[model samples]
Target: MSDVGALGDPALEDALTGLARRRTVLVASDLDGALAEFTRDPADTVPAPGAMLALRGLARLPGTSVAVVSGRDAATLAELTGVRPGDPVALVGSHGAESSVAGVTAQRLDDGQRALLDELTTTVAELIERHRGARLERKRAAVAVHTRGLSDDAEQAALEEAVGLGEGRDDVRVLRGKSVVELSVSHADKGSALLALARVVGAESVFYSGDDVTDEDAFRVLPAADGHVTVKVGDGGTAAEHRVPSVGALVVVVRRLLALRSDLAPGAR
Candidate 1:
């Protein structure tokens, strides 16, 4: 089978093959589109088929680190992934604001941004409550307006309203996510977060996977230029080093590693 999805490109394959040989792999995957299906709320979200095994597989890899980075908070990722003993993986939640290793105390939002919560909630309530199926999500350091309602008109209007909220803050990115509009106060994105972790681990290479416009930012920056592989889940104009048809394929890649590690584990006897 010709690898036709993300990581199918020869350049990306060569990079991953090379990475497997020398670097301490850092597989930072986005939670939603990249792993789990983009859902309207946390209560309804489900982890992708191989997500748990993938984390376990990375944990077993020598000097390899895997993180489930998402817009969800730290507690949420840990709970959803069904984390067990000896898991070296990190959960970069709330868009890198709530990291299990960094601790919540380290998470910060600008004073001005923090103080705007009241206004944001009121406005968010006003904007989404009026539309059928519209949902509101208040993340740790960011706010989201989920329009999975799939109404193009509603989505367009919601984007404008989201941008309006940051009218004075040009530094803020009014990123359009898959079916949601997000407002984040922290400058750290999935990419920066990945790079920071890789640098801390003295990484020689990086393999980053994501499935949204936000993931695109991280795709632009990879550790040690040549040894990095980028995988984009689903279709988009992402500059990722590779592109996978869907999260399922992403899970397939993850499963491969998991199976590899499982075979190496001590026998059941």
Candidate 2:
């Protein structure tokens, strides 16, 4: 939770540089608001200029792996990022409930889980109808109520109502984010996904960046060590040890890491 201000902090820079030289490292990040700007319509979000290229550069480095961990479904995440089968970057979607590395795949919901999701989706849709500016996002294993464009009071009411809908449902898990409340049938979380990805790649260290409450799960799972760097891309309380002002600033950080890794690559002059 130490707030190392901006990427220019000498200590942070040194840590990132050192991490780049590690024998095995994993770079994972949240897609929206970390690698790409958040759009009112999630479908419209796109990566910041050169962001994907920077990630690809890191993936190319020796003993390095990269992943985009997002709330979007696996296919949608892969489509949005333009990452196809056989790409080096892995995709973890639905807050880690679903994953795609060589190809897209999703968690299979059982009959009970499907029933719960149906009920939750119906409830959220009803709530959206009652409140203007409220939107419902249906995912593979979850349904989200987004209140971004609503008035503060209206948003609070909508969120509370959504929470109430899930109060007695043991079959579902409730999660609150920046301006959205999600009811998920699957218990998967960013912490589990990050750890699993690290294990798969045999990464000795992990550098992760994210900008939402969901991102906190990933932040908490990273070991407290010089090789591990966790960064919060925007304002608000976070478990990450460093902070950058915005997604644009995060792109700069990625590019810098790519350059550092390039400089340290074997046989570099």
Candidate 3:
């Protein structure tokens, strides 16, 4: 195993080792920018090298749970991550609004909620049409305006227009991420999703990593007293207790966790 100390933060390293020793632990992470590199086209994103293998390996360890919590829909996340049904790693998609867990589904939107989504979609679509480099991403329960290719002024204008549409709409929730603005009928956030997964799996501690503004929700929800590891993957303001420099560094973190768990397993050298 590589030196745990070299993983960057000593406290984070110690916390991860402690989690490895726990009887029940949850390792959850965001996909875009966390496990996968961010791309102009979200569909083009894939997991960093060895990331999926590490997650699957960690999940196979006794008493450990792994989950991918993402903003993409569950099916898309599964397809992109190559997660088949019955895989050890769980999937939470649409920023926690959807999941692959049995008997768990996103709450159905009421008629009014549906109308709000329609309005949001139409409004964002119009803005996208006006902006030369903007694009619209339609999800099962949400719609997003992507400004990755837009000029600074156009991106700001698109964001402002999108935000205006949701003004005082209690049923609608707006979320801002890296060069994107999303409106969702469901109010689920990564924090709620992570908490729910932890409760279902009876996790004594959870280690979550993310690299977007939305990831702060998960970071805030992790139990601080349990020494849960919250890692931010890139440069940004974050609530995560620890920060890794890039997706490459995140891969190392996962490998380090795997090594620590391997050492703690029975019959280890």
Error in Å for residue 147 of model 1: 0.6
Stretches of candidate 2 above 4 Å error? 1-6, 102-106, 265-269
**lDDT score at residue 32, model 2, on the 0-100 scale:** 88
lDDT of 2 by residue, 13-53 (tens): 87688887777888889998899998777778899999999
- Write model 1 residue lDDT over 1-269, tens digit each, in one string: 12346435565455555666653666778888778887656557888876777776676677677778787777767777775445687777776666665422345776787877556767878887666667787766667788775578977777677768766776555667777777776666776777777776666677777888888778888633667777778876867766778888888766654454344422311
Q: Which clashing pairs does model 1 show?
A: 6-243, 6-244
After superposition, candidate 3 runs with Cα above 4 Å error: 1-6, 103-105, 265-269
lDDT of 3 by residue, 13-128 (tens): 78788878887888989999889988888888889999999999998888888999999988889999999998999999998888877544566668887887788788788887
TM-score of each: 0.85, 0.93, 0.92
What local lDDT score does residue 26 receive in model 3, on the 0 to 100 scale? 86
In model 1, state the lDDT of residue 107.
58
